[model samples]
Target: MSGFESNPFADPVDVNPFQDASITQATSGATENVGEFNPFAGTNSGKTIPISAASSQPAVLQTSMEQSAQENAAAGQASLIKQQEELERKAADLERREQELQTGMENNWPPLPSFSPVKPCFYQDFEEDIPEEYHRICKRMYYLWMCIATLFLNVLACLAYFTADSASGVDFGLAILWFVLFTPVSFICWYRPVYKAFRSDSSFSFFFFFFVFFFQVAVYVIQTVGIPRWGNSGWIAAISMIRVNLAVAVVMMVVAGFFTVNAILSVILLKMVHSKYRRTGASFTKAQQEFSSGVLTNRTVQTAATSAASAAAQGAFGRNQEN
Candidate 1:
């Protein structure tokens, strides 16, 4: 029975496949590789790609922003400097223009021939003296004065024709006197004042112009009415003469129409001058100051004052000697 259990399939000596040298060595090697493995380690090439820290990134970004801000400030400063240079150039141009005008004012007005007996008593230049804003109005005033002179001549002619038939030679003589009297006086009184006012922005001249021009407007109204024996061929005088001579009346009516036009223009110009005056910053106080200064600075006034002082000094010396 013992021999039957121990058959030929079973090895006589004890043997195990798991205990072989080659298999044992392979398992030991695999276990050692697993134990030495590390996921965070560098690759086998021995080179690494360095990553920047969060704190270091902020420093680099801040340096770039500071450089951009500096560039913007430099640009702004350059713009301001350019604007200042432009303003200075404009100021220089204005000053040059003012100097040219001052030099031009030395020449005489009317520019009459030197050999002529009549000399220019005033200086006038619209471009040199009058501001650009007041040039048109100043020229209009001059034209108005010329029209007034022409109207006076027309009135004289009408009166001379009226005197040929009517017994009233007085009207013709008075017309001649008015032509001679008012032509020069009106030029000096109102026209010159307004011219000087616009030229120099003189408050005193402005006030004088206003005063004289008011009377001038009143004269225009009276002349338009054509009072009898007043040298004016006004509406009433023209209508009355229609009974005797239609031709003479027609001439007189034309003169009356011209006078009416003059009156209307005078009122309009008065308002215009007042509006200009308001813009000039003129006032009563400034006018008074200018008048006082002008009087004090006058050569005649200074001479008179010197003479009076000398006379008083002599008189006081005489009184002291007598005492």
Candidate 2:
């Protein structure tokens, strides 16, 4: 009892939470506080060294942060440069595409069967270039084709009229009408066109050729129907004798084909001539004008230099050849 009472009477010191730990631990903390109180605590004093690597950990971390910032800045600049290069490449591609479209390069042909004579067409007129003798022969041949086509067509019409068979009844009225229509039409188409060429040296023979060919076209349609019905000569006529009728029709078709071919060829040739005319320095209009204006009156074209001659010929002031 005496020992326990004595132990209770002897009490240990009571620690307060608000007490200054440094004042209490001054003996153990005095060295650390010396650096903490110093103004330049992070930097070493002249020639002083760190006692341990842990003491320099904060400085090493600060260095690492600075290095990371610099690397990030450099990487950002590199990214910006790459982005600029990509934009320039896209711009160059757009510019190249724009240049390609400026030139007319879509693949398609011009509209066909144009009636205007000013435009180059498949049909042309070159009767002027052909020798007079050859042209006369061509004209004679054309007329002969016309006559032969007309005669056969008439015979076909006669057979279709007389026969009741569907094969024998081959559009006789159409054939007769074509014969009546195209015989004179063929002459008119070429005759007046050539006459204009001879008389005025008109550059537009193509216009008249196509215009007149409109009439000759009906002959083609009519002839196509007539041959199946028209009996070969008026002798032994029957549906069973279609072979003979076909032969007659074939002959008629041949004649009609010749006429049509001639007309088409004439138009083609005329177009070729007109193409040449465009290249030539003198056109019919300029030549006619020069003649009327007295610029070419007895003036030999061989006298002047070619360039001047070309300029004059292109205009209404060319020198013409003297006979």
Candidate 3:
């Protein structure tokens, strides 16, 4: 009788609300059961059932994805660590190689000792220690030093002569004394001073050494002249001693030659030093300026002045008190 009733005469049409309702209820109940089901839930035998493909497929895929991501992250971290370690090792190797090369280069030159019994005053490995610009001048100074040493040997040779002739023991003793006195004195006074002057471009030291060394050059000349009765083999003794004994003559001649060589070298080196000093634009005026500056800036001078001023102040105070 209602619109929901089935029409069988005109057109075959069914309208069954209860049937549709029952179908919907059945579907909803099945969905509820599926949602309530747990794969890890205990069974009658206390064992969990395996999850159905429909429920577990997404979880399995998600777990596999997470595990893959973690593995990739771990692999990336390991690779970065390896790269960092390799870079550090390479840097260390490079630094070690550089040090080895430096050591090898340094080994090429002869090393000088800090102290020596004979040559105790100055020690410098010219090629390795001095600046390139000063090498020529320093070499000249070293040659001069060697010449002084040779001069000592000449004195020893003269001493040997006097040892053979006991009557001339005075000359031998004097020769020995000269060797002892002159060797260290010349080195410390003239040679070392000139070395420092040229090396430092100092005008005052250069002039001071010049005046002292001029006297040294004069002594060399007098020795080369070879006056008789002296320990040195002047030209007079060198030729005359040859007739007495061939060995004595040879020693005297050698000594004479050493003196001549020393004289010539000293003059040459002096000229060279003068030229260098001039090239540096150093002059007497500059030397005076340096000396004045040195005296003005001296600690002792300043201290003395301070004491004098304080004493004067105290004296004035005493006089004022008396007044």
* Model number with the top lDDT: 1
TM-score of each: 0.62, 0.31, 0.54
Overall local distance difference test of candidate 1: 0.82
Q: Which stretches of candidate 3 lie over 4 Å from their true place?
A: 1-131, 300-323
Candidate 1 per-residue lDDT over residues 62-181, each given as its tens digit = 999999999999999999899999987887788679778666665575578999888777777889779999998999888777767645755565575566557556667777777788
Q: By descending lDDT, how would the candidates be arranged?
A: 1, 3, 2
lDDT of 2 by residue, 113-132 (tens): 45744442222233634455
Candidate 3: pairs in clash: 226-234, 226-235
Task: Identify the candidate with maximal TM-score.
Answer: 1
lDDT of 2 at 185: 60
Residue 125: error of model 3 in Å?
5.2
Poorest lDDT segment (10 consecutive residues) of candidate 3: 105-114
Model 2 TM-score, all chains together? 0.31
